[model samples]
Target: MPLTFIDIERQKNWRIVLFFLVLMALYLLAAALFFAALLPGPLSAEPRFWVFLVIAAALTASIHFWFSASNAVDTVVRRLNAQPPDLKDDVHRMFANIIQELHVVTGAKRNIRCAVIPSLSLNALAAADLKGNAVIAITEGLLSRLSRPQVEAVVAHEAHHILSGDCLETTVAASIFGTFSSAMEKVRYSSSNRLFASPAFLLAWVLLQLGYLVNLFISREREYRADAAAVRMTRNPLALAETLHFLSRGWRGAGFIGSGFEMLCIVNPVATTLDETEGFLPDLLSTHPPIKKRLEILLQMARVSITELDANAERRSGRKGTDAQERYFVMSPARLWQGPFTAGELDALPWLSPLTWVANGKGKTAERAWKDPLLNTIFLRRLAGDGRIESGFTCPVCKQPLVTAAYEGTQIVQCGFCAGTLVENGRIPRIIARTGRERPCTERLNALARSVLQQNQARNIYRKVAARGAGQVPLLPCPKCKNPMFRGFYSTAHLIEVDRCSNCGLTWFDQDELEMLQCLIENRLLPDITVAVKD
Candidate 1:
């Protein structure tokens, strides 16, 4: 290829193509010389022989290049997670800006994409699609270090890879050359002895080494092209240059891959251990172009002074009044995973059983109660079976005595004295939470409330009696509310007694009390719940 064109940013006048034409021709000549050396002597000067050799060598080179680049793409990709990104805010917006600018500056027809890795490692790379899926990934560290413009510049470069079809070239190369690289890795890893002398295979070994270096050279060329494309799009080369400078500076030893792949990223290899930047040869095959040269290109953009970005983050410290990320609580945590739907609504969801909602709801309830460190049904249920407590409970509302009824494997205490119901499931609906929001005198209620309280206190003492006697004295202390429990023969269960708590209106029952309570509620038993007529 002859010198056709080049678009230099420093002078926006004369467009020059074939800017790398000399380099290309020089590389072609070198390729020819190398092939002439590698092939057999008999066909050395033959035209048809040279032609066949050229085609074979070129084809092999193409496949090796494609596989190598593809494998590198795959390697870095496997190192990454391919999931929908939960992006950092600024980085997300920067990617958006990059896409927008790429379209505006270079008219990239495709959409830009991104993914996040939770790792705090400072690195980023672009991977071309073998199948033409141009995806650009930015790191969490990119967000932490680079300002909006710098990030935008990085994205623009990646987008440039997409826009200029560098991804196509790279993807092809990686797909072909990456296969050879995999074999290289197998040999490198499988060798038991640290070293192998290959005098007979010297040229093969050297070619293998050259293959590694060639892959790097391809990576370096793509980066330069991407860099130039990025500047062309952003018109802000300085930011990209500055971003690269700081990017490599902060990246120390982190991900431990062969440094051979370092040039594939926007910065140095994460494991880089050198400060020598001026030497071009040290970084000649380096994927990242020199920051100084890049900055020179960036100075072409209007001189913009660098201002220090704020590094001190406002972390959430659980102080009483400090501003923090605001949170919202739905009806339950189950709603969060099941997604903004009520427990009942969750029952009808596809691929989910109706019963699942129940378990998830219970788990959510337990989690909330445990986090709260307050009294709840779990503690209340602990007092259920002590003999001193009676089977019947009174509704705190109606003051009418209530009996236990099971609904769908759960117990509800329903008031006989009034039309009040306590589900005992810890869910007082909004109507309920608001209905009796006013704190009643914990000390008093009307006659109906009082009757219930009396039964409650009796139940507490009866539990104590039963726990202590185990069927003998029939009187004991209520471990639940720490109130006294005593024995009293209720007609429903004259055969046994249970414990109850007076202060907290809890009743204990012997195991059969549920049946006994049902009998009492059905008017089958004449318990000593004799009524006092109001005057």
Candidate 2:
């Protein structure tokens, strides 16, 4: 095993040459078979015919190889819709800084460009082409969620791949046949006809299968090598270990990242049983090793166990709550004083605001919540996240001015107090497309989603059987149009209750409803249609 970057073995260019030769052989065989089936004469016995076939196959292979490998970096960046890191943005700036730091540490071996994929998937990839262009692209979700050290570890891992020259070979391999395979997949899904029966489709499928054969040449051990190199560079095995753990539980771009690009990514975007298991066949077929094994190896290096790592993560994420010594009493909306509550508990109250009357303890003098320094931080944080811009519209529920807040890279008006959001109909698809592994679908949210779906399902059934409309519920006035909005399920398919104003083309999602809808769709949680209903 290489202990230093200088010790890493240089990739043999002959491997790429061999790959080209194999591609030519496949093309030649395919062409010969194709012509033999169509022509009646013994074409194989004719020397001139053989010569012409060889030249045709060689030309075709050369074109395919050059087209796929020449501009691979650009091809991949375009496919993922990656953009250069926004130097003005904090997170993007930090990512850019890290890439610069990587360059400095490596003595500027290669001027690797950096890009940010506008996806919410937690995956990063490195691509190097024959043009000597190399780029490291990370998803927005990963950059936002990972700490600086964790992000450094990920960048280092991808950088090592590029520096060691494996990235170029892998890019070429994925490009040659994988690109066509991915294109064919999209075509197959989009077409309504029997695309599988098409001769062109069959040929592409054959080539795609042959593309998988390239994985045989690309060793899974490269990932382990990259991981080791990253650790050597960062000198923080625990950070990478924690990141691997987080990624294992989070979404890794299953549907968003295209096929055949898995080998280039730090982790397989699409999880497979073969990827997580180890054996003779898996070793030969899988492009990545088991994440669990990787984690164990890293944890050993860090001198920590998985349990400790989990505990540390929980503490960092604030999942492990602690008992608060200082408590405050707050006046409820009903003009009654609520019992003493911790600051954390107070923050959870939707109605609690800076103007709300609060006391340090039972009989203490009541003052505005903001007067207390501890409670003021909550409001300050809220303002920082959701109060940057005040939208003209008011919240339908809170009757307070809505703030323009960023959600999934799009702007939406949200109530700072009630946390309700008002979004235009046109922006809904963009928001949903952007929502992915950024936030985990908690069990609480999942349970609420399932219950809501079941209730909506039952309600629909009752309305259909009784030949009556939905039961009357108090409708909130539309923020944009002051008219009462229609409250109903977002769709029959999703069944998440939402308020919509037909005149304004706006929708209101109360508190957690928007996240619930995103969770429902992300996990594909369906309503139990067989649920019993009572009149």
Tens-digit per-residue lDDT, 332-449, candidate 2: 9999999689888998998898668899864669987767888878876776675377788977764556788888888888888778888899998887777664667799998998
Cα RMSD to the true fold for all candidates: 13.9, 23.2
lDDT of 1 at 192: 40
In model 1, which runs have C-alpha deviations exceeding 4 angstroms? 1-76, 86-105, 110-113, 129-131, 144-147, 165-182, 191-205, 215-232, 235-242, 252-260, 270-276, 279-283, 296-535
Candidate that would win on lDDT: 2
* Top TM-score hit: 2
Instruction: Compose the digit string of candidate 1's lDDT tens values, residues 1-535.
Output: 1111123222221111221233233333334444554443543365887787667666655554445444544455565663335445655665655556655554344555565544556666666654455566666766656777777788777765555554544444344334444554565566544223322224435554554444433434556666776776666776776776566456532553234434445665553333224455545544455555565555556464333211211121234234432221233434544344443343334333211222222235413221221212222232352222323553332222345654334555543323234433142222223322332223222333344434644554565555543445535444333445644543333333335454654444443343333333333233345433223
| RMSD after Cα superposition, model 2 | 23.2
Per-model C-alpha lDDT, please? 0.46, 0.83
Quality of model 1 by C-alpha lDDT: 0.46
TM-score of each: 0.42, 0.58
Question: Which window of ten consecutive residues has the lowest lDDT sum in model 1?
Answer: 308-317
lDDT of 2: 0.83
